[model samples]
Target chain A: MSIHNVIQVEGLTKKFGDFTAVNAISFKVEKGEIFGFLGANGAGKTTAMKMLIGISIPSSGKATVAGFDVFTHAESIKKSIGYMSQKFALYDDLTVKENITFFGGIYGLSRKRIRQKSAVLIEELGLEKVANKLVGALPLGWKQKLSFSVSMIHDPKIVFLDEPTGGVDPITRRQFWEMIYKAANQGITVFVTTHYMDEAEYCDRVSIMVNGKIEALDTPKKLKEQFKVANMNDVFLKLARG
Target chain B: MSICVANISKSYKNVKALQDISFNVKVGELFGIIGPDGAGKTTLFRILTTLLFADNGRATVSGWDVVSDYKNIRKSVGYMPGRFSLYQDLTVEENLQFFATIFGTTIEENYDLIKDIYVQIEPFKDRRAGKLSGGMKQKLALCCALIHKPKVLFLDEPTTGVDPVSRKEFWEMLKRLQQKNITILVSTPYMDEAALCDRIALIQDGKILEIDTPEAIVKHYPKPIYNVSANNMYKLINSLNAYQYIHSVYPFGEFVHYTDKRAEFNAVELKLYLESKNLSNIRIEKTVATIEDTFMELAK
Candidate 1:
């Protein structure tokens, strides 16, 4: 019930028939915080995210996103949050400008506001030259940036990014984190999942999931200290080995 | 040399995949080709494995020519491509048997070479390859590749989709294989894994930027870097970028990796500059360069 907490969950669980994909996990995310959700493949990170984002119903638990109950107000939660999946969600065939306008329209943005926002976004991302270019023709790094920008076109209160910088070079990954920092600075809660341990260090706090359960959750530094490891990667190895 | 490439160039239509790439791997050495996607690591692997011919180059694998002695090269090399190419419907045991039979060998004949990996997957021997978890599938793939006891093993992005724990275990297994005198050539986009290899080549835009040990690569970074942060990280990056005395600035996790234009950069002066801009909670300190920092410096 904390006013500062943008997301609150208690005993959130999901099951696929007899298989429990997400165990009774609980966590609270404060407004404008970058929350890192770390887990291995098939560790139920995606299923847990789906439940929090209001796309998947939990079998048993209490959850609230942006002050709305996940079960009763999933529609309102959807409108208040933006999501970028592991796969690029923008239309590849659409031009940079068109993709922006399209996503903005889907969020109930008016034509005038969409046009103004598109201009500012293109300029900010250094995409003015390729504003009319098809997204398919852009490099992977540029496409990722554009997709992230499009996701935030409506200025949602929370953004969920899944593996935003997969396969990108170090430089691009660094720049992408800047964008996340920028969003969080403007009071948007960012819930992200990534395999890269270095990215875990960027989070204000991180939760490591193992076998459908959250094995550890804390600031990266504290988790590293608790596990007697030098970095988040070693911390993950220690917890996952258990 | 266990493997060698000279003046290798490859292109498909209008796009250049590799440009004048050259490197050598010694006997029993673990060599890593590290780069992002579209960096031509796969193309280089395909050429050395004799699956694809290079447009211009001479190469050898285990002292056999990649082109003229391709058949001999194939016999001496184990290649696990980027994708899982095993029979999805087939069980783990069947896949191992199938690979061994194709190489004109039996599982029992080369069981010693794959005993460690095979034992882990043996409990699930009857499970379909596709039904196994990411880590289990990788173990099966490694076992299949080692059945014939090939002198050289080529693994393309073996740990890409696997979890961090499995990734650590995979590298440990590779170290054990190294003790067996197998020359391992692995490619991955992960910079952290580069440190695990004996020597690594950082590739980008189809060119090898640097080839050396991970420690040596980090030592080669020619600048004093600082980790800088403030309350407004986004504005801090922009202000740092616009600063007159800054050489380069890029975000690194929670802080920015910064280098000043002056050789003897003053951390206090940088802090004062941020304070002058009304930024609070400022923290700046000299930080050691990592393999990733070195890669970015070289790529730039």
Candidate 2:
């Protein structure tokens, strides 16, 4: 892995009213690494992601995404990163090709460039035959893959996936992780948050958020060894319980 | 049988929601209906709960026919739909009272049955159901469902979208309920949760793949599998997939779960091959099967 850090945060915090959704947390993510951010629902995982993605302003802290300050260069950070939220950002009514074209247009890609990228993407995912099929008509697995590929259509420096594999069958989930691996292989830093502890095992490193504070951060193997647990799920259970 | 389903089938237009599905739950057993979305879990739940009818076959819940004895079934069974169906505008306390009154009983009459689950949410009694957190809302829903002291409870995806901590607590609540001899039939898409059930019916495309204890199902895994990982997981998986002798390759946790067609596979030889491919930090070990592994094998 490269020593270059794509993301850096120190004493980051966010508060709403009296509740601190994210406490003073500090961490750094290296370029070309898969970083897994974990927490239970309402554990500030979403809040932290929003702050890092530059959508939500942090109450206090220092952070940067892709060498751009999250506070001042939020707009530049937005342009330099791609985000795939839990609720898919695809237009279900649109055909596969149409969805790609629309997202490409949103990213300001030229018509010719969009066409080129769409062709390569369709061929890569074996969606050549269903390129014109409505996204709603495709199976859950196909739609997930299509949504992920669309997120990378712009080839940003980093990609953030929030619960990308929820509700997908085991087979489809495996296939989706393969896509994540390929993206990381191509040197795109992957920042992902998931409820599925098993997915944590695939990351180069992970940080577990509890309440509003980052309780644990390390390689998955080390975290498991430190907690003296058989798997990531037990590690999470122990942390969440505490 | 606390619940019995025999040759149940249902269809909506051209789509078959359920097909010849059958299962039984003994009194006090925690039965699980496991499947993904569109797997007909909701339809089956609706049928048993008397909210919908099956086009064919028969079912009985709590010794009452779902069709002929709908009224009795409704009285003896508590049903919690997949989605949060309680009144969003009502306060937590008000929702519980409304359910209790509709069942012709006061909360005081069955307070003991719901006390363990309800006490946690009692502090939020004034909070609107919509304003409560996902976990708190689930607890209130469960409280209202059990307010009438129903003999059987049906919870559809109770833990979906809940945090890991809340999910664990909810399952503990289910176990506590089982002590009162309340036959619980729960459904979830999460394969790990299947292990918590006494017996689970794995469903896919509206068909039952297997019905057995989680342990027995894992014991039946057809192949000896290996957990394999290397510095570059992407390359490791690709190499495994391209290997002629490999039968199946899927990502499992931090490693790739591998199966080979050969009777006797050599882990060292495979390691040497991966080494030649310039893959470092390789780790391979025999691993026991899990519900997810069994589910994938059966799904294929």
Candidate 3:
């Protein structure tokens, strides 16, 4: 594997009984690249992501995340990467400060380091006034932003975001993307999945999965040209519909 | 009017969910409530559908009071909540039959109303609702919601988390449903979908920001927008934001949508400034305002 490639996969397949959830998908993600993983609903995006994140075992495949083999070093892979999903990320009952500190501890940071990190995180996010409030009381946009920050508290080499800006307001959604750009500029690879096509355009490269396999993978401009469409949304509609 | 809401307000504990919300939907009109999550959209929908009560003000559906005449409203309107609310254990066909029976109607009685949508999911009629795919489940839910042939339909974020293709198909189905003379009121966070509605209400922070046709809303933008692009997106955004004449900078697809604080701005001067910052391959062009632009301006 190349030193710059943070994630390398070859013939990665996951099967359940008679069904193949992810079929022989292969791709490489370079360091600090924003990779967009897109597919229709029930196209095995979640399953493929699960295998890559080291939470699920691939039935038959060769994959490495952060230089750790998925089959042999699953635990190491989990520790080397950060993950946040729209459905579940942070504990709602916990306060913002507590949530940040808890995630820091989970990532095995010392108590002193956790304190320093939490202070910086609170100030950076401008959450000084609401740091003591329960996360459940915060607005949806604030919760999403806090969740992203908490996921990165460990400063992993790569972060996986699943629909991070699903229902956020227009401005907050843009703000969230700006945060992503900052992370990428700091040399952290971002593997993200989103339903919004405009957000898809923000990625450096995008791979569209259909049925259990990746049918097309390229930059937004190339994909648009290859499909003879005007935008990513049209390309997606043509591919997914077919 | 098919639906009327006057000064509706609701609160939960210390959080104000809805405040002084008012709107009216004409008969056979395809109206939309466009907002993001926790914007009091669900609260207003529940009150109008008679599933929940407002702490103040009043509402009516089909000219009947939502409180005193809830039973009539319930029978005359179809509601599909944001989440998949069908019985998971039951087959798709069985769920539809059950909903039809509860409404004191038969599938044959209202077959024409949901024929277009139901046919798409008929292949999975024997499958349990829980086992269906996301798109199939959405179709099944819509089918059940229309089995009774109500005069009005209330869909609360029906396409939330759905893919772009399915979202387009769902909107087409709604347009066809409108031809049958049913007043449709749907809510979604997608600004693009707002254009499909005859009129839309943009809501945020439990308050109605604006209510007008999507075209009119875009025209309300006070400044001319420009599509600005450079080789590096991140640096371009930062440099634009740091510019003295920058009014607003938001990243659109493949470009940054920028507006100037000055009434008469020169694009050439801005291009030269970016060039000084070591940016190359710069492009700037005037672009029309979209619903999202209007929404952000209003919300701000």
- What local lDDT score does residue A62 receive in model 3, on the 0 to 100 scale? 97
- Strongest candidate by lDDT: 3
Per-residue lDDT tens digits of candidate 1, residues B174-222?
A: 9999999999999999999999999999999899999999999999999
Which pairs of residues clash in candidate 3, taking residues 3 or more apart in a chain or in different chains?
none
Stretch of 10 with least lDDT, candidate 2 chain A: A1-10
Q: What tens digits encode model 2's per-residue C-alpha lDDT throughout B1-300?
A: 999999999998888999999989999999999887778999999999999999999999988899999999998889898889999999999999999999999999999989988889888899999999888989999998899999999999998767678899999999999999999999998899999999999998889999999999999999999999888789999999888789889988888899989999998999998998899999989998889888889998
Residue B85 in candidate 3 has what lDDT?
98
Each candidate's interface RMSD (Å, one decimal) is 1.6, 1.1, 0.6
| Candidate with the larger DockQ of 1 and 3 | 3
Candidate 3: misplaced stretches above 4 Å? none
